[model samples]
Target: MTEGKRAIIQQLLQEYDIQDAQDIQDALKDLLGGTIKEMMESEMDQHLGYEKSERTESEDADRNYRNGYKSKRVNSSYGSMDIDVPQDRHSSFEPKVVKKRQKDISDIDQKIISMYAKGMTTKQISETIDDIYGFEASEGFISDVTDKILPQIEEWQERPLSAVYPIVFIDAIHFSVRDDGVIRKLAAYVVLGINSDGRKEVLSLVIGENESSKYWLSVLNSLKNRGVQDILILCSDGLSGIKEAIQTAFPKTEQQRCIVHMVRNTLKYVANKDMKAFAKDLKTIYTASDEKTALSQLDRVTDKWDGQYPYAMKRWHENWDAISPIFKFSKDVRTAFYTTNAIESLNSTLRRLNRQRSVFPSSQALLKALYLATFEATKKWTSPIRNWGKVRGELSIMYPDRMPD
Candidate 1:
């Protein structure tokens, strides 16, 4: 039977020059219906040397059927291929869920990583594997394997960036971290970039305890270290001390306060009785057609609330210098800088990942999960951002030294 199979393979080579395992598998798949009878007849009762079973040709077909075989299929990194898994076993042959531990299951890894990113618990992942892929996965092995994505995360974090970013949206996401061996809400400063091609790429991620200027400076410094020479507009919440930090670190950068955040912050001080009236006025201040209209609305909002809530007006005044500039740019620019919405979406994705985690054992573990989540999330960044061409052209004119060659 073995000799005959070899003869068939030799004949196939002579006739078609097909030799690779993937080609063989593809051939086998095509040859399955046509060759099944011939293979059954030739190797009917041949001993396959599998544990605990021996039978003749008819017997093997009836009782000791073949389930599947492992072979290497050359892909980007030679992915493991389950070439023509035969379901010959009648009972008790529950094929292992992960298919013989073939390394670099890119397809499976993507599936598992996506599920893991969406808040699936390890147990849930195991169940999902069983249900979807027909594999039994140990919880610990799954965790260990998923956590292995950190090196990739490190590589991604340290990757080089384009020379110029016209507009950058920066925000911090707080998460529990292992600090001096204790878990706490350490802030992670994240940046989103609108590059010359209009692609919105994530520029950087940093971990810190608080979103202070000193910490943000360190984050910005890391970005500079990675190759970002200049930025035209930087949008963020009113993180005190960040303005001077941006000017000092990214000397040529312009800072814009997130108008959405400013309004929300001011609303906190508005009395409940006047909240509705204040919101109506708030819309006028931020939603106006032009900078002049916006400024006029702001004066009215302040005048109405200032005498009663002096601190609210004072806070708005303090942030006015930062928020006002956004109104001067094009409508597209205004929409983009109105808030830190870019990072906000990323934060939502991270939140979903954490919700599944519940309580993380350590920060490294958290980082591992987040890294995988981000990797999967990036797959959905399939196209460049809107008005990116216009924004990029604007950036080139604004910061000529920063545009990439």
Candidate 2:
């Protein structure tokens, strides 16, 4: 270090009587408090157009001047410190360094918001702030800080989407929230889309009273209003009335039922001893090279298992139209759209974050937590899906009129 700077440090050490780390922190806090006090005094002098105890020739009789000092305690990284804020007779002098009514001087508000986004409870966040920054942050204070993102969440939910999406996945994650002292289950519908460039994007998220095709219809209508004119393929679990909703919103869009969900549903009725063999036979139907071969395998599996599990075979026949679309695509495209794993993986992340809070105070609170977690989870979606080049080529051929150049 330079000799001049080194001397200044030596003088400060002597003046503060520094001995250890705690002493150094106390000394720095005092210095910071004094520096803020001096800055505010300078600001007051500039506002009054004269230095303290000095008179200017052009000063008027009714000019504004410093009245007295107001004691205020502010929290900072160096711990909490008290400051004597200068006041004016007219109350027109605003301090830029520490704005009026802003108690926490450090970036503690952002820290609280970050913690809240990671599914930390307000009480936990408050304790964390106290442990790390040596200050007590109330739960109410943390909630107020996180509420600042409500507008941002609304903007993101309403933002316009691309005119066309090559593929979209729709799914729901359930949460419990309090409504008039009664805890009820609610659904958060997540709509994820793959744009023409083949990148994954979370299009929208909304909280509904329950998981229903009616609520999904409204969500789809909102997407249509936002600018989604065409979606080549939409994949989802076999929820009742969802097909009708899709047909109503975008009649031309092809629907692909989630093969994983179908498998799970079929296996639900099969005996545990037979599940492995049953699943193996079921895989043959979906893994076939073409639709004709898949249908033949379906017939074979039906003949083998129908006597024991007729309902399982019945579900396949009932939903054959929705389940057979993947057979028309090549391996790469089929792999991408055959299941709802992309969106389900997203839901799993949300669920992991949501586990900390068993019941939220309200729907808005639940949405805020989810929005923050979703934002954090989606940060890694910086690139397109794997083998997107070939997938896009197949989509282009599949939907020539809809695919953008």
Candidate 3:
């Protein structure tokens, strides 16, 4: 140590009545303990709007006052310490820095949750905590930390939705989860909706055994129960029975088959050598100004390719009713309903986090991770949809009674 620093330390020791290293350490502990006690008293003062022993003759004096102090042993990086927490007469002063019955004085729990949300495994999270905090934390403790948010996630899932959504996109992403000692692939059905303000929000995340229409109908029922009265457009892939389910549950809703998925499924039937040329020809059909023009171009392509690729042409013609909704609206509104890209983008983010986990221990575990990931992913959706004003104008004209004023 430098001579100046040594002299300063010596001066502090002499002034503070410290005699040795142990004494200095004890003094420092006393200082911290006293500061915490004082802060608690200060918090009570703020809560009651007056310090201890301070009185007023007015009616305010009859309000709450300091009752007593309760002792709590809190674990800190400086080692365990005992501090006295002040209480109010009404037992209502809740201290934020040190809450009642809190055991730890550090932010280790929050750090563990943040790391887990970024797709870190339990072992990795534990190791990270150990490395940074100089203490070992068990995986069970880490699990407990993440499990605390499960109830909140469940509540979020069941919360009421808006009365109407202008457009909603639905899609399913698959994951492996262990159920009853057997690992199985599960489908996470996601719903992204645009509310009256044109802001996008995740409506629901449902875990199912598979992406069957039966589970999807249950999801739609859940939405209906949560007050989703009308949905102008519901976009999805050409999943079987979905259109029927929508007809039964929400007869007014129009099904818009995902044009991107249609294009992808059509390309699967085209030969590798003809994919580029075929895609160019397929574009002419979807991008046409109106249904009549689009169908005319589609017929031209059917004439050119039907002899070689009958199934692709047949699939397009079969789903023409579902695909026709996009053509009725203007280009901006039509483009929004033509694909499920909004929800697909959300799924892409979940997939990135899911890539780190080969299999989840349970459905609850998968849901917890998904909820956290969704929370983090939606932060970027701060602005309204592109060309929202124009689309809203068109939608208002189409659904005059349904649109929000």
Model number with the top lDDT: 2
Predicted candidate 1 versus true structure: per-residue lDDT over 1-405, tens digit per residue: 699999987887776658577776556545543343334323422333343254344543345655543233311122223333234444333233223334433466666666777767678887877665445666886787677677778898999988777788877666755567676776666678877666678876665565567877888888899998888789988776789789889887888888777777878988899878877888887777777888888888888778888877676666777777766557775676678876666778888765666566566666666666666677787787666666566656656667765
Ranking by TM-score: 2, 3, 1
Q: How much lDDT does candidate 1 score? A: 0.68
Candidate 3 lDDT, tens digit per residue, 20-62? 7767766766667788898888888889888788874557655
lDDT of model 1 at residue 380?
Answer: 80
Predictions in order: lDDT: 0.68, 0.88, 0.84
Residue 154's lDDT within candidate 3 is 82
Give me the runs in candidate 1 sitting further than 4 Å from their true place: 1-111, 130-136, 176-183, 287-294, 389-405
C-alpha lDDT of residue 362 in model 1: 63
RMSD in angstroms between candidate 2 and the native structure over all alpha carbons: 2.0
- Give per-model CA RMSD: 11.7, 2.0, 7.0
CA displacement after TM-score superposition, residue 59 of candidate 1 (Å): 38
Residue pairs clashing, model 3: none
Off by over 4 Å in 3: 1-101, 211-213
